[model samples]
Target: MTETLASTSSPTATSGGTPPPEAAWINAYERLSPRWQSSALSPQSVIPIAISRVNQVDAGRLDIEMSAMLKEQMVKVFSVMKPGLLFQYEAELDAFLEFLIWRFSIWVDKPTPGNALMNLRYRDERATDMRGKIRTGLEGPGLTVYQKILYCIATVGGQYIWTRLQSFSAFRQWGDSEQRTLARRAWLIVQRIEGLYKAASFTNLLVFLFTGRYRNLIERALRARLVYGSPHMNRAVSFEYMNRQLVWNEFSEMLLLLLPLLNSSTMKNFLSPFSKDKASGSSGDETLCPICQTNPTTVYLALPCQHRYCYYCLRTRCAATPSFRCSRCSEPVVAMQRHGGSVP
Candidate 1:
């Protein structure tokens, strides 16, 4: 009975002989036992994708600002040369900066400054196989050398070429060429192409909203998708400064809305008593106008206060407000007099 039980559990006994070399042996208990299985990683939500786009926009803005600063420095260096000369090469300067960014970032399989901030990197979707263990749902193969080169050509070179073409066509007035002429036909073709591109972009945007992949047409064409670089890393952006800025912006807007309605003269009169110079009982400067705070070209004196002021400044104030008071002494100015003459 003991021998029969042992034989029944063995693979050789089941086959009536030794198992074939190709067949693998498994313990009965191991075969019957439940194995641990890992759940598949979930697809990324839309929020991170949107944040990545925002980061990209910010990176572009930073690039533009840097370009402007570089241009300013270059202009300073060539200040003695003809003015507006550097403006002619502005487009070239921008293209050069963009090329440097692409050369270092995409070519090296490194995340862009924007993508790096969000812990995201581009992955070649065509080469990625979904069957393997994917820890963050972002695991995939990095862009190949060919893909990187093509990306640079498509993004940087393509944009520069298109821009130049458009500018040249506009400058040459291709649209205003003789009817049915080649130039006119070319212009119409360009317009149609632009419209088609815009329509395609709109469709792509809707699809992206539904699926949360491929933020731009270039990305969609290349199959280079942004994915998280680190499974454990969180977003690096902080909203504290943004919150403060929003609060200040709201406060400034409110002030702007309310300020125009308030009486400027009343507000000035109300705040005048708190003035340090007024409290000290000293007319601040004899040569400088009390209202304008500059050396008066034609000095005049307020009737009761005798504070010196510019002729136009005092005349406009008295004309606008019949009850115009001395800015320094807070006394009613009934009339004005030239600095060396009697009251006029």
Candidate 2:
């Protein structure tokens, strides 16, 4: 039995007694199984996933800005028309902008501006077959003409129709109609549909977190997946500048919070000795009150310190605090004297 097994294995083995390289490789690949092969071609890491989300947000923001600009220009052209007349067509304007984006981007087989910047493009998962070796794991066929049309209909047309329907329903007070009425029933159905859509979107989000495939309901329903556009390119977006901007914003916010609690006079007195111009002494402009930084109409002098101040300003400060000090010289003010005469 051992001699018969050796003769059978000899045909597959090489001269050195090891099995041929090609045969060994084929056997190893076969051992992977279909399940393992699918797992091997799983979605990308967190970076790409996060970038895809950022791209979606960016695209939405771009659409909003473009719509705003177009609306502003239209408003200028129709300036003579009744104010807020164009506001009635805001939904139409938004739909037009969305259509323009779809026509230029998805319709032309090119990625949206945001997706292009992030080096990502949408791929039709329905038509893609994961049989061959995927070099960068991003290799897939672009969306077909049918998929693109459906995407546009689902996103642009669907949104416009839903918005107009809601507005019309609300305008006609359908929800307030008799409970048994058709209008009331239609309103309830719309609300239920909206609720179902929201619930489905939440569930899709959970699935996306684990699979890193579809980021939104539209993509999942359309079978369109975002993938890397360039196989050789690295991540296009950089967080370094954003990190620095956040740091600066936090620092500024901290300063804003702490600034109100600080005493400007105390800080000036504390840092006065270190000032380079300290030895220069007070300037010749004695008419100006150091506290208010204005020329006082009725100048009053602080006793011992002899620094000038507005009468009301000095009186208010002295009354507010018994141990009021000179704002300029930082000396305790024992009495107030008029600029030209003594006052008790």
Candidate 3:
């Protein structure tokens, strides 16, 4: 797994090289979400800062400025990320990145609060969809690395691409071999993510893949880092609103890269195999998994959270210990059970 946490070694930028824009953004994300930072912040804050900072500069004029800014920010974000967690949750990191791109794209064009908020919701849905696509065998390949990166960035701001993927399905509708081949390649990216973060536990997987409408909060916090400002508002939304939580400190940049992969419906469908009730509840008669439908009879029912998982799926997850905790809710699971167990 790639390192999730940033390097402790400070960033050393070669001034001559065309520095990656994300590098600076990553650093800013870290400084704002720092473990030692006195204030606690939600990821939702990343937006307001971006909007306000670049508000004065048009996209064309701000290109160079944003590039420099991103390099500065990335160094900070990567420095604090945990390498082991990155290795363990590499797939998740990528998925998060894919989600970010989808939403970021939308926000770049329309940075309104409503648009920004919608993008975060779109991120969760997109991530959930990508999980599913991986399982159902419909994701298309043929996208170049640049295309993947652009897709991820675009989706970061919640640029909707579900229609695009579904449109591609026209080929599958007619049984086109070439189309299916492309879908398979797209599906592979999500599969790779699941394998990387498999040990993250069902709840963690859910929150990591879905939930957390706090992108705006992160944007705000990040904005503060750039201007050395403080948070000025509350970003909490009630459960009725379907709020989801995503970890930022150790996983922001990796999350940035995965944004495109999560944008796919196939990826969301594959992840749906894990559980429903996001918070807690019964799986009921649903044979297909809530996140990814492929795995039936999820042998492992994570206690407390009640998320179910197929035995092989659970076994494939890597961890140093047999006992694991739900990544979504942070509840502990003593052992895998055939049936769902009560929270204790």
Candidate 4:
């Protein structure tokens, strides 16, 4: 994979569009009544169930009941999820992993839900807030890097709201505009992390590590992104599949691995292709990918003669050659295929 100089820059604001100031988020938090904020910030606000522990040696046991907020509302919000999974120490983490397994299984076994986050509302009535629409505006046919970053955040949040909330509550509770901005930051963080992990230069790590057991499912999850450079997709659900538990499990596992990556700055680098001007349709002639025609695939020059080919096509053709031969000159095929293929 190509290494772009790493920078700790803040995620770009929507081009031609300004971001709401930080105070806007603070203001949103302020919008919540004092009582709500007081409660929300408290550990009890979200967890209503009572927690009890006993010291075996002392034989002194303490039981504390959860606040009404948890019993009446918060827990209900998450009731669809298994109990003892939210914050059950090690057990909780394991539960989370199991949740992922269930989620992925759903994607693999059934028809994935269409418009996963279509219901999400945007603060500005004129502005589209549905994840798909916002995503299109940001990473659609002619999106910019800024746009792709924006969309990645939106799309990630839309699909993985629960997991993200578990890891970053501040983001979950953010106001509409604030959520967008924070989501951008989260995406950058993940990108950087993924890059760091990838720097080791293992081409098959994603495949080798994640492919077995969930092989078909993994491919389905990654296929559109790898092939079309689009990350906003409604998962495919198989017909007659009602195994929700299995589906949720797979999704849960996928998120545990995916959430951290999206939160890393290095991991954000992988999003380059999605934001490249080619996808945005801004490059005119320079932008279309020859192989797919829908997006601009990265191009590379062959050795000696410097003939160019779409990175995807070049790989297949070059692999059969001995010295990485130039298609035009039919020279030797010697160029080594890099990890993660080439980015457009």
List residue ranges in candidate 1 displaced over 4 A.
1-81, 177-180, 235-239, 264-344
Look at candidate 2 and tell me the lDDT of residue 24: 47
TM-score of each: 0.62, 0.68, 0.17, 0.14
The better candidate by lDDT, 2 or 3, is: 2
Candidate 1 C-alpha lDDT tens digits along 225-299: 878788778757677999999999999999999999996767877987787767555445566887777998888
Q: Evaluate model 3: give its lDDT.
A: 0.41
Q: Across residues 1-344, which tens digit of lDDT does each residue of candidate 2 receive? A: 34533444456373666665466456555654665757665664212323355554555455567667866886788789888887899788778878887899999999876677667788988877654445323666899999999999998999999999999999888899554599999999999999999999999988877676787899998889888787667655577998999999999999999999998778898898899987667576655887777889987889988888998899899999999988776778999999788785
Q: How far does residue 132 in candidate 1 sit from its true spot (Å)?
A: 6.0
lDDT of 4 by residue, 1-344 (tens): 01111121124543444665676456555655675656646544332211111111011111012122223454556668888765444333333433443344222332112212221111111233333323322232222344334433433333355454545544464433445786767666665765864654254444434432111222233222111122454223243455777798899999998897663433444554576553554435333433345342555644444444567777776565444544333456456332245422
Query: Comparing candidate 2 with candidate 4, which one achieves the higher lDDT?
Result: 2
Question: How many residue pairs clash in all the candidates, one count each?
Answer: 0, 0, 111, 59
Deviation in Å, model 3, residue 160 alpha carbon: 4.6
Which is the better candidate, 3 or 4, if ranked by lDDT?
3
Q: For candidate 2, report its TM-score.
A: 0.68
Score candidate 2 by lDDT.
0.78
Model 3 segments more than 4 A misplaced? 1-111, 114-152, 156-162, 171-344
Candidate 3 local lDDT, 49-124, one digit each (tens): 2223222122223333443454456445776777655444433444454454434643343222332322211221
